[model samples]
Target: MTTIEIDHTSRWFGNVVAVNDVSMTVGPGVTGLLGPNGAGKSTLINMMAGFLAPSTGKVTLDGKQIWRNEAVYRAIGIVPEREGMYDFLTGREFVVANAELHGLDAAAAGRALATVEMEYAQDRKIATYSKGMRQRVKMASALVHDPSVLLLDEPFNGMDPRQRMQLMELLRRMGAEGRTVLFSSHILEEVEQLASHIEVVVAGRHAASGDFRRIRRLMTDRPHRYTVRSSDDRALAAALIADPSTAGIEVDTTEGALLIQAVDFGRFTALLPQVARAHGIRLLTVSPSDESLESVFSYLVAA
Candidate 1:
């Protein structure tokens, strides 16, 4: 398996800079390209798949340029976000066409179809397939050549949990075989569950790149605000403020609750309950105030 490298790359469209000075190496393993919507993940994937060229620097696979290099397709397989596969062709025929493009025969198509478990409906035209079915068919096309490097863009979109799990298992296996697998996603849990390493992009800029847990810890270190209502609000706030983990605690007059800003998320979570128990305060509600994905993503972008 070969590693893909992006060195000082930047892409732009007239006034819009899609990817700005982002460089990273993706090697053998399942890597999650994490980003919010409109974060240029798609643009980066396209460049890696040789679908687009950067305005500056280079994208290479084992030191060979990827852009406009037809030979690179022999080593790379791509599943793009756009759903423009041959709809008139049957599932089997579609895969057969893909195999034929790789100079293989119908048997190669059948094997790829079987791997994705789409043989049952392989005879049906792709026009009748649902989004998830189309996804599996697209996956079959990418796998038909058994390429070492696989690039997928939002591969889990519109998939059910079972379908999602199946795809995840397949990717994990490919990664174990030393194939470089990179997929883009906006969801945190998908990346957290499937990838040990992650690269985060924000506002068309490379934000963070490394282990998922390390990036996660950086996010978790941000203040975690929560709203809590207890039997004795003042007493609970007093006890919570005594701990260094609690950055700031405010007693809301109209809301009749405590607004807590926790600098240390993990420590504060544990500290809050313990403080309540020890102070003999009964908690009526303990809801996280800033648990939305947008907030988490914005924080990463800001950082």
Candidate 2:
């Protein structure tokens, strides 16, 4: 449908630089823009949606500029992260107004509501709707135009599990239809399950961009440090320390567990169970100390 390009773009706010000189391309398919809190992800999404301007570079849809460009709306539909949508209007009324803004009528509005499966509650006032309901209504308003590019910022912030799955499926279907769909999130599992492609950001800087598997491997390639408790700590540590895949290991006397720094994630994982079974050690608990996304992301960004 539409391709978006960000070229050496930078934005600032007085003394705080919001977005550094970063560049990337977002094309047809679901792309998860991932970053920690206050990492300028929302600022980047706003620029792409024509709601904000880059102070030092260009954000374009295909070849057309996205900033100060009202004509781009015909091809761009945005579901913003800000939770300030109209609360007085009913669902149907809100969607109808969105259609009217795009020079369409109520029929198109109704279809949009149906597409989001919100027709059943279309008559209810938005003021009484739940967070998830409000999210879906906002999605319907954005979909009313059937634009080529769809941009969503933190779209699943307050949604329940079922609502999250439904929205993910809808976005996947839209991407399959050749519509470019991009959403931002800080949750690693959400990005992993929803978007195969990922772009990671940290502290207003672009960290990594590629398939999720590559990123996952980069994060997992270093020694996977884990604390394990088993029936035989001494025996297990002795056996594991002999293996070349295990760089270092220590038996924690206070915690009564073994600290293992595994060099090869895949090899260590497979060797663990086999060694335990062969040595007749019943494992109590195995936990990775550095498995959190925050640490991984920080490492990637620092690199």
Listed per model in order, the count of residue pairs whose N, CA or C atoms clash below 3 Å is 0, 0
lDDT of 1 by residue, 1-303 (tens): 699999999999899999999999999999999988988999999999999999998999999999999999999989989999989999999999999999999999999999899999999999999988999999999999999999999999989999999999989998998999999999989999999899999888999999999999888988889999999999999899998999898999999999999999989888888988998999999999988877887888777
Which residue pairs in candidate 2 collide? none
On residues 6-108, what C-alpha lDDT tens digit does candidate 2 reach at each position?
A: 9999989898998999899999999999988888899999999988999999999998998999999999889987778788999999999999999999999
What 10-residue stretch in candidate 2 is worst by lDDT?
Answer: 294-303
Model 2 error, position 72 (Å): 1.5
Q: Which ranges in model 2 have alpha carbons more than 4 Å from their true place?
A: none
Model 2 global lDDT (CA atoms, 0 to 1): 0.91
